[model samples]
Target: MKVLLKGTSLLLLILAGTVMGCKSPENASNFPKRPNILFAIADDQSFPHAGAYGFAEIKTPAFDKVAKDGVLFNNAFVAAPQCSPSRAAILTGKNIWQLEEAGTHASSFPKKLNVFTDMLEDAGYQLGYTGKAWGPGNWKIAGWDRNPVGPAYNEKELTTVPSTGINKRDYFGNFSHFLEKRATGKPFFFWYGGHEPHRVYEPGSGAKAGKRFKNVQLPGFLPDDSVTRNDVIDYAFEIEYFDAHLLKMLKLLEEKGELANTVVVVTADNGMPFPYAKANLQEYGTHVPLAISWPDQIKSSKKVDDLVSMIDLAPTFLEIAGIKSAPVMTGQSIVPVLFSKGGENTSKRNYVLTGRERHTHARPDNLGYPARAIRTKEYLYVKNYKPERWPVGDPVPPNDENNKRAQTEGFKTLFPGYHDIDGSPSKTFMMKHQHEESVNRLFKNAFEKRPEAQLFDIQNDPECLYDLSGNTEYSDICADLRNKLDQELTKQGDPRMFGSDIFDSYPRYSPMRNFQGFNARGQYNPAYAD
Candidate 1:
């Protein structure tokens, strides 16, 4: 049986040695004893960028070394493309929809939920985190005592950084700080959340670091120009910078003689912070780099191509640590896949589902762009709840005085829509060159209005430039995927399936934007007051 609770009582499980208030996983441990967990997650990074993933631009020696020592995952994905929701999934072992307020960007974390960190702590594993945890949101309002990710070791700070907007927190020093505070001779679970490679890079930082532009390769969606290549190089510089700290942490673990017993996982929260990348649920937005190294338990120098979700990491960690997961957790553990000696036997993990809502309050009335997706090995199907709404966000929001006006009556167009896209050098180039034929394609792809239903063959079109949903040749395939998605959502009791409309009604907790209402398609509607 599983432990299920609701309301304020859910947070009362501060008692030790309990597994979601259910039976302990120690009863089911047939393998060796539990291992220490050191999860290192990067902020705003995408797949095919790590050196281990064969991306030529980035140099991730630390990530590559981890892959060499353990298993490298080629197809790793997070539940949402945004930071708050993606990290919420990692903590709860559930999808975005299951998390209520936490499913949206910068919203309140629901205190009723049971996260893996809490479970591990109750099971007697010492836990703490440094750098960014589950964020861009207010965790205190939810009634919990601390951030859902864990306690903070952010007392220490550093000044030297390679670029602007990169986190200056000494992550390696914090990890060492966490080690000093733990109880003697006990298993530990430490989260090293690196705030790197998100956005706001120093101009020409890559060139400043002596990185050659020839090694940069732009994705198919972006233009093959010098600016885009240089932009990507700057991103690479951040990746390498982030990796450098992990290298030092690995050395520290080795020095402590805990390297063999530590389950080291290195990944990211979401995709790159760029237009048509981070906020959108596209291939690049959701696909992330993953490398897990545990020299004691799993095989070395291997690769696993199984479709795995970031949420699944919670259950995997819980299971390995001899703690049972909460019943609300939908993510399946990858322990079996890890111990299977690097074989393609993951028949149950055929689908990788993800979705997003309201990543930023860029639209009038704090409206969210709701979307759900189901990705199989062959194709990817998407269902947009509101096709009439701008996919990125409204071009401009209402003014401070008029922000509280009716949301859907009407408005005037200001700038081109797609404010959900992050501010970046590559985006600046596309916006500046929209008049040219070669660059307009790039702008349209990022700012265009998509249909209610979208389908893409991920194998052939990982960029998702062409929509195969309406094509007659793929009608049956589209219908099958739709049916599959609806059935799964229905089984999971998703509010969307029940016509609940809860997602839209949920209060937008992020600070509202006041940019003046735009181009007559939408109107003013303030989300919520502070």
Candidate 2:
């Protein structure tokens, strides 16, 4: 065995030819010794939105193909509802709470944390990524020389695009470039991080593309109106765009004779960028679509209903590559689930936990709405540590002059205050109609303060429209879930258990917004100063 340095910081190990013997299923004589890993992650997408999930309005033939070829996971949740922290959880194989600064949104990734990609690189797998990877935050600020995911292959750009909001970067072209640059006979780990279906969609693009508002299914948390429906349709268009690239990548792999030897896992960073989702701990916010396929190892056309967390992905990848997970990683590997032939599988989780701290500069002093949740097969119990703080954000004053400026420069740029929800046509429409009798309840659900403890029977109320915490009949169920959540969070060393403000003390790296009383002095966190 030999070790070599690549570039300035990356320590690439060049193992002897004998390294080829390190395979997951050594007995499979026809399979490649070490399978290549192709991980495709969409920017902001929810579960049941893919064609494989019976969402006919959303065209996702590529995702459907993967589901048909492998396992389709019915219950997959992220550690955080926001992209940065959720992505960090996937890379580190730890829940957002288990991570310190890395746990919060738009915060620096601590250098000491070990990511599976780094471990894969050290074990002789060629590592690279294209499009969005492990950020919306600064990895370099925390002492990394490059993006935490891997090297970038985002040079290729599309000349003509379908929508203005869609990224022009040719995701498929860049993937081809990565394949061209790979070292011979080395198993590769490539991240196709598509920055699609997020927010700021081209208004009415769905209508122009021949999509009807009638076909769009509005979630119960949102208003059942044309404006909101169109917004969802536009979101679907971007999702289809993301899937198109995945199809191209799959075709390229097949042409290269690498499809059968590759492990393909497709999912999203978080849910759709919407008011009651995205940064929130609701079902759509945390639960995401997941499909995994490996011709040589995994069985085909199976649907798994077991609870799975995004953190488990890192451990699974490491196990497949014949590498061990980091000691700090708390997630259990799903390799057993993957290898299961069918019914009565060994992989089953009692519950999966999710939480969040800070999203954007939505409140004064950059304070985040702190909350933790526990989701079992039947119910979801959430405990808002600070129920006093507004869940979405402090409301923007109606008479503020910034409202006019926001119309021109956008709500996000001028900070019209409900900054947790991304600036979009749907948000604008909802705010305009918040005073109306028909839309008032939906608006309040999306943006309002809440009780500390809330419980929902997710199976019955998938929309989470009714909180069962206050109901006497469900009191026992709520109490049981709360006790379970507290015990596990305490055992896992969550700072929130000790009433620590550690998450809020982490410095934010993205563009800051000015809310009421948000001054320069309040913006700085000296504890995290360089």
Q: Which candidate tops TM-score?
A: 2
**C-alpha displacement of 58 in model 1, angstroms?**
0.9
Poorest 10 consecutive residues by lDDT, candidate 1: 521-530
On lDDT, the candidate that comes out on top is: 2
Candidate 2 Cα outliers beyond 4 Å, as residue runs: 1-32, 343-345, 401-415, 516-530
**Could you tell me the C-alpha RMSD of candidate 1 in Å?**
6.0
Q: Write the per-residue lDDT of candidate 1 for residues 448-518, one digit (tens) a residue.
A: 77899999899999888888988999999989888998877665555566544455545545545554432
Instruction: Give me candidate 1's TM-score against the actual structure.
Output: 0.89
- Give lDDT: candidate 2, residue 20: 18
Q: lDDT at 286 for candidate 2?
A: 94
| Candidate 2 lDDT over residue span 260-338, tens digit each | 8799999999999987889889898999999999977665678888888998898788777776424446676787777
TM-score of 2: 0.90
RMSD of each: 6.0, 7.1
Task: Tell me each candidate's TM-score.
Answer: 0.89, 0.90
What lDDT does the true structure give each of the candidates? Answer: 0.79, 0.82
